[model samples]
Each structure stands twice: as structure tokens, then as C-alpha cells.
Target: MTEQKTPPPPQIWPTLRAADARALIRFLVTAFGFEETVTYGDGDRVDHCQLSWPPGGGLMLGSVRDETDDAWALQPGTFGAYVVTDEPDKLAERARAAGAVIVKEPFDTDYGSRDFAARDPEGNLWAFGTYRGEPR
Candidate 1:
């Protein structure tokens, strides 16, 4: 008998409707290093879309309507996402060039990591930091 292919791991996808989803997808890819997996929608409304890092889940973007109650879609400028990176300084520079507002300059943390944060056009926060502590 032939073996069936295993499905990929499930991911928590967040939906937003305050604005166009395509624009967000593009930003995530270029700024955050996420890859656009797939998108679903019509001429002007994006029903849902998936985005992630090359190897696995990172982020998902989608659209919403007045009838929907997804918490993620309700708040446009109040959401933030933190991600770890190996080069916080370089990522900060890239983010600045991509038009993201630099909310915090790169700084070393007591936790032994160089970290910095930025805000996108939609007000989503992106944190890039490097881990400097040895494994316990």
C-alpha cells in the first residue's frame, strides 16, 4: 500500500481587516524575513493569507469585515511581535530603510543580549535581538 503524505504542523493564524492584507504581507516578507505562503481573497477583499519564515511558521496575515470579531483584526496599532535575530543592529538598519519607525535604539540587555525594536507603518512592533547567554 502507498503511504499518504504527512500534513505540515498547525499554526496560529491572525487576521486583520483595518486595511489591505496584501500590503501587510509584502511588508512582513521584505522587512521581517517572512515568506508569503499563500493568500485567499477576491478582487479587493482578502479573506485569509498565510506567511512565515522559510522553514516554518512566523506570521499570518488576513482581512476581516464588520461582522468578524477576531481580536487581532480589531486593533490596528496596538499589536506587537517579538522575534529573535542574530544581528539586531543590521536588522534595525534594514527596518529603518524599509520605512519602519525606530522606536528604540539597539542596546545591550541585562539578559545578555543585544536587542532593539521598531514599529511598522501599521504600528506593529518588531524586535530583533541576539542571545548571548550560554545554555544552562
Candidate 2:
């Protein structure tokens, strides 16, 4: 048998700001199966958080702040990301059960990917699919 190598941890993190960071975090965890790895800040203001996708990548996020308060002024509800998954159908079902808005049902892409799109409670667009992206 051939040996397999473990992939390195993700270095590039997709980040977003949420108006209701705590609730958004909960929704992401419950609706999409993102693991809540770490969270900072007190009360409802999430200064920083890392939600790890079980499949080997993760994302960073924080509470929204005014432009004057934070240099990264990413607006809530304006973020979008595509997540790779092996089971888009089951994931979509789970998302729907958790009340995620289905923007697009599972479909086959021309390039041979099974994908589906949904909107998070914060209005961020999340596409889950079987595409692992082109080899680097």
C-alpha cells in the first residue's frame, strides 16, 4: 500500500463580518455543520471567531463595526463563499431543516460538480459542492 500524506492546515482564511455575530455563528454551526472552534469577545460582540469546516478548511469572522472603529469594514450580508463537500444533497437537506434559504437546489455543473447554494441568516451566500478546486 502507498503512504498518504496529511495536508497542511489552511493558511488563507475566508473572513466576514456579521451584524449579529453570535447568532450568525450559531446559524452557521447548526445549519451548515461548521464547527465552532474558537470565539473571542464578551456578550454579543464577537471580536474574533474561527469556524472550522470538517473537510479540512475553515473561515474566520467577527462582529461588524463601524469603519471608524475597524479598518476592515466588510459589510454584513455582502459576503459569499464556496465550500467543498462530498455530499451536497445531504448537506442541503440539513441546511433546509435548519431554515437556511435555498437559493439553488443541488445541480450538476458543466465541469462535473454537484452543487447547491443557500443564504445564511446574515444573507451571506454559501455554495456547497463536490468541487475540490483545480490542483495547484
Candidate 3:
């Protein structure tokens, strides 16, 4: 009998565009506790940026391009993400201190998770929560 081999899981990373990529990078670091891994661009013009959250996870971003006709064209705030955190309240406090727009204060859900929602400087929605979803 032959043994079947399982394929590796796909790698998915959320990509976003920011009006002020430099400022956005700083905001993400100060507020969301993301550490910069790599950034490409000169001066304030960021062509691409990558950040790593402590322990695990990462995100990619870049400055909004002027090309409007391309399929990759996207506006600031077009993307939203839900980040898993061990401490939602602490994260919320840090985000608030860094001037993130708090759309919803930290609250407990009936499903037994603590969560909060906030908007980035460019208006992208971010939800931090303890919930990891259900396993199949």
C-alpha cells in the first residue's frame, strides 16, 4: 500500500496601501506593537514595507500608487484585519495612546472572547481579539 502525503498549508499575508506609508509604519509599531522587518523606498515614499508582530504573524504594506486603472490599485483603508492577541485590553490601551481611532472599546463577547475595534490613521479597520475561531 502507498502512503498519501499531505500538502503544506498556503501562506497568506494581508497586503495594504497607506496614504502616508512612513507615518503608518510608525503608527503600527507604536500602537500595534509590530516590529519592522523590511522597508523599501526613499525618504517618505515607501514602495513596500513589512512588519512582524512579536511571537508570530506578520503584515505587508506599501504606499498608495497613483495608477488608477490597474487591477492592483487600492485605496487607503480598503483592507481590514483581525489580529489575535493574548491581551486585548493592553493592546487597546497602547493603540489609544498612539492616537488610533477607537471605534469600539474593549468588551467581552457572549461567545467568551474579549475584543476591540479600532481604525488606523488611514482608516483601515483593525479588530484585536482573543478568539481564534472554531476548529473543524
Best lDDT goes to which candidate? 2
Enumerate residue pairs that collide in model 1: none
Candidate 1 Cα outliers beyond 4 Å, as residue runs: 1-18, 67-73, 131-136
TM-score of each: 0.75, 0.91, 0.87
Candidate number with the higher lDDT (2 or 3) = 2
* TM-score: model 3 vs. ground truth: 0.87
Off by over 4 Å in 3: 1-10, 68-70
What TM value does model 1 have? 0.75
**lDDT (0-100) at residue 53 of candidate 1?**
57
lDDT of 1 by residue, 57-87 (tens): 4665666466465544465555676665777
Predict model 3's lDDT versus the native: 0.87
lDDT of candidate 2? 0.93
Q: Show the colliding residue pairs in model 3.
A: none
Q: After superposition, how far is residue 23 of candidate 1 from its true place, in Å?
A: 1.1
Expressed as tens digits, the lDDT of each residue in 19-57 for candidate 2 is 999999999999999999999999999999999999778
For candidate 3, the 10 contiguous residues with the lowest summed lDDT are 2-11
- Count of backbone clashes, every candidate in sequence: 0, 0, 0
User: Which model is ahead, 1 or 2, in terms of lDDT?
Assistant: 2
Winner by TM-score between candidate 2 and candidate 1: 2
